[model samples]
Target: MNRAVIVAAKRTPIGKVGGILKDFEPDMLASFVIESLLHETKVSKEEINDVILGNVVGPGGNIARLAALTAGLPYHVPGVTVDRQCGSGLEAVNLAARLVQAGAGDIYLAGGVESTSRAPWKVEKPTSLYREAPHIFTRARFSTEEIGDPEMGEAAENVAEKYNISKDKQDLYSLKSHQKAVKAMESGRYLEELVPVHLLTRTGEKMVIAEDECPRKNTTIEKLSKLKPVFRENGTVTAGNACPINDGAALVLIMSERKCRELGLVPKLCFIDSAAAGVDPNFLGIGPVPAVTKLLNRTGLSMIDIDLVEFNEAFASQVLASLQLLNIPEEKVNVSGGALALGHPYGASGAVLVTRLMIEMKQKKARYGLATLGIGGGLGLASLFERIEE
Candidate 1:
């Protein structure tokens, strides 16, 4: 297969649930990032062959197609929408690389977007089982098996319990995440990848949301310890340790080496390998362990060979568990902070993490970087990128 390389990657500043981007729709947010990418790279609209978008919640229209048109891309360009929960963004990138490697497309845009502020509140219709079995009022059998999807918070709590992770340990990890994120921000490490988004306020005032608004600047172990668990009464997964709802979008341009040379574009990172694994749905948060192992084995590289790692911080416990299971060094993981500090815009998280990883590797002059994430419904996805030196 021919090699595929990333020519450019960019992301809008992650906004908190009620922050500057709260009013923007997911498609609109995606369009903004895509437009910025085209302008920065000076790539013409007609050059793009395909646009792949990742979205977790919204109307079920063809978001990628709509986003492409919304961003002023040529109407002739085809688009596809993908959904792999939190891994959607990264999966889109992986798919785009495959297309280029197969010589199916010369240029592609892959990314994800989420607008939690506009997330639709799903209301399920009452099923026959629920209506007929009114007497079965227990929590375990309240609804039909097919209709009873547990919330992420409950799934995280289950993972914590199964792994025997303590609440104090999670709290401590969360505190470290915030501290590291604050340090990264204070040093302006994220400035390179984060595009400043000018948004309108509630009263039509313009404002720029440049910095991440989720990381608790004053977060401490003591402060986190006082918060109650949101999933279970005695659960370890608390609001302080879990990724918050967020709004953002991230995009990456992938093309074959020949195509980049033809366009006089510098290839930044070469795609190495990507893998996705499935596990028990109840332990969904720990899905990354097997996925990363498979990816490393396939590439004939050990965890130590990876110079940088961006494992989406879905929760402190899940992240800690995945690291311990993979025998990955903590120091090599999320050096610039993660979702806990930045924000986790579910559909856009995977691509966002990969973009951050690329920027971090470039800044540190690293050789290899790993971008991985645990997705909802017991799935894990990972991709390896090698810095392309001139």
Candidate 2:
């Protein structure tokens, strides 16, 4: 297998649903990122072997193709889209790494994009008796009735109950997430990976959005604890502890070592290993345990070797439980905060994590970094990256 290296990774500021980015299409947002990457890296679009994107709730078309064309890339560049729900973005990166390893391609552009605001209402099959517009939120995209899929929040509730995680602990974690995020935002630690973009308003107004839109400056544990449980009456998960629906896009330029040398491009991070795992749908939040453990075992490395970890904050309960199962110190995970504070743009968050992790690794001069996310329907995805230069 050929070694794959990441040349650059970047993401748009995650916008809350109905926020600054509500009007932008996911494909258009992705194209903007693609164009920014090409211009920043000076990499010719023709050199790209493929453009693979991870997307969900975008009207179910070829998002990659749309993004590529919108970015004005040559028509010959093959484009592919992968849908793994929340893990789609990182899955796309993993697929690109594997492609390089398998000698299938030398250079690839991969990432994820999502626009919850633009998600259309779906319709179910018509019936003689009655028919109404299907609720996309109610529909289980991952499994059918026989498979018994549960909503993400409901799964988080199951995790909290199964692991005996307390409401206090969940609220505490949620508070930490916001505090870290606010601190990072104030210090501008997130600036390195952010790509400023213009957002259009309903009344023909334009705003330049440059930072994540979900962090609350006045977040406190007390405030978090006071919020009522949203998933269930007695559930530990609350709106304050859960990731907000969001809009955003993220991408990375992946290339083989030889390709990097050929193009005179510096390798920022080396893709070392990745793994995906599954768990029961009810406890889907625990999916990261097997996925991350498998990756560490295969790499013969310990969580101790990882200087930073980006575990998606799908919910405070889910992340807290996964951290407990992995026995990793809280300080080592999401040091700059997570989805709880930044918002979850679903399909785009995985790649956003990778982009954030790599940037932090450089700033902290870390040796190894890991990015991982748990998906809907019992799936977990993880990837390990090493700093290749500086």
Candidate 3:
């Protein structure tokens, strides 16, 4: 058996739907970060044994393989794509770790990419005898009809009502998320991990997209309160509190300890444990609690031992409810911000959140950190990272 460690992590600045990254393919976005990691770590292309990417919606021909070809990796480096909705990215990393731990591979590249702007409108094929319009929906079904696959916003609402979380509390958490993200951006915290994206405009102009386009500098609780609920009439969930449709990509290099030493790459974080759990589809937001509990149990650690946490803020109510149920402090989680402030790009968000924890944990010299997120259909994924003590 072997151990896996994180040697590199990087992401493109998240773009709002129909925004800066709209023209880029999800495969291209993924390749950009993977190439950046290879360059940053000075790792040879031949050293990469596999490329695994997580993606939610797009043209579905194994985007990871497309990325590998686009990035000019050799033919021997194959790619695999996984879809666990929002948990896909972290789950890719988790699977990579397992492979390394089982002595299957020495080096691997795993992460996620999403191009909401480019996701094609999927319409079911119409029979010649059938009626006029085809139902166009890009997202795939969550589960069997008996299990139920409620819309994500509806699940957030269920989480809020089921846990008795109030609208005011949700708004408060949203405000703080914006505040923290704004502060982190102003302080250049994201620059360390951001890979600047370059775009050539239609009119022969060069455009540079460097910062996340979602966080609002003027966001306030008052403004959020004035917004109408989106999921249900009189519901606590609102456009301002839930994640926006976003486009982005992120990648991390995980290598066995032997491979790290062989390449002279300094590992920043080591994999401690990872787990997944599921719940009733309606209350999907609470999924993380059980996933984290399982992860903690595996690591034989407590919340007190976790110096930082990144709970994807799919909805403010969802995050708040989970924190309350788990007895975790808000201050300990998403210290720099979360999906609410940064925009959630579905599959890419999990890896992006993990990158956030890695940077913060290293800066704070924290002992342990947990990165976790709930999926759209009752699933949650959690991964524990231990800072490499210098």
Candidate 4:
């Protein structure tokens, strides 16, 4: 049996939709982090067994292979792309670890990338032969019509209503997220894991995007309280309480424990285990509860045994509901804020959580860290990690 360990992780600064990263291609964004990881770990591309990446909305092609080639890896290094909606990135890492355990490969580069601004327009084929035009499809169907697939915002409303999470609570949680993110940014805590993207202006001037662009330093509960619901007229979920569309890429270098030791590479976090679960699509926000519960139970651990948690903040209501159901304190999760303030780049958010968790664990000198998130279509995924002692 082999253990998978992460030796290096890096991510591009998240950009708001139509923001600084809009002009960059998804493959290029992913390549930047891939190149950075290789440089930081001093690893050769020839040693990589595979490249895996998660992507949601982009041009219809294999982005992992495109990114690997863009990053200048050899032709022999094959790449594959995975799509599990918001859980895609976490699943990619999980697959990489499983491959290592299966003795299929020793080294793997795995993560995710998303560029909402550049996502191509999609259309569904006409249902009838007589129909001449295709209908625009904003998102892919996650469930059959019979099963009832609500928009993510509507699902958040369902979770809030079912779990008694109020509008005021959601607003307050979002405010705290912004506050914590502002504090972290001010202290330069995020710089350690960030890889700057250098861009050229139209005038040939150079520009460097090195910091996240979405955190509001002066966010207030008053402002959040004033915002109306986006999905329903009387719903609690609002733009203020939900994550913004964003663009970014994140990657981590994973290698077998034996190979990591052989290369004299220091392991940051040892991959312990991973779990996935599905729930009612209407209350999709509660997805993480069962997922995390199964993970802890299978590993013979509890919330008390975990030191830190990174629950993707797709919506404040969902986050609060899931935390309450799991009996996990809010203080133990997202110590430096989450997608509510940092922005969520869809497919890349899960990997971003892992990247942040590794850094937080090292700084806090914690032992166990968990990365978990509720995915689109009522799915939940979780991965557990243990920090390596220096």
The list of candidate 2 runs beyond 4 A from truth reads 129-137, 144-147, 200-206
Q: Please report the candidate that would top lDDT against the real structure.
A: 4
Model 3, 86-153: lDDT tens digits are 99999889888889999989899999999999998888887854676787875677766887778889
lDDT of 2 by residue, 1-390 (tens): 789999999899999998878888888889888998898989998989999999987877789999999999999998999999899999999999999989999989999999999987776665644556443454546666686677888889999999998999988888889899999999989887888998666688877889888999898887887999987997888999898999999999999999888989898889998999998877889889999999999999998898899999999888988999898899988998999999999889989999998888888888999999988989899999999764
Say which prediction, candidate 1 or candidate 2, comes out ahead on TM-score. Answer: 2
lDDT of each: 0.86, 0.89, 0.90, 0.94
For candidate 4, the TM-score is 0.98
Candidate 3: TM-score? Answer: 0.98
User: RMSD, each candidate, Å?
Assistant: 3.6, 1.7, 1.2, 1.1
Report residue 199 deviation for candidate 2 (angstroms).
Answer: 3.3
Tens-place lDDT per residue, model 4, 1-390, is 799999988899999999999999999999999999999888989999999999999886999999999999999999999998999998999999999988999999999999999999997767786567777888888877888889989989999999999999999999999999999999999999999999999999999999999999878999999999999899899999999999999998999999998999999999999999999988887888899999999999999999999999999999999999899999999999999999999889889999999999999999999999998888999999999998
Greater TM-score among 3 and 4 belongs to 4
Q: State every prediction's TM-score relative to the real structure.
A: 0.93, 0.96, 0.98, 0.98
Of 1 and 3, the candidate ranking higher by lDDT: 3
The whole-model C-alpha lDDT of candidate 1 against the native structure comes to: 0.86
Q: Give one clash count per candidate, in the order shown.
A: 0, 0, 0, 0
Candidate closer to the true structure by lDDT (higher is better), 2 or 4: 4
Instruction: Provide the lowest-lDDT 10-residue window in model 1.
Output: 135-144
Query: Which TM-score value belongs to model 1?
Result: 0.93
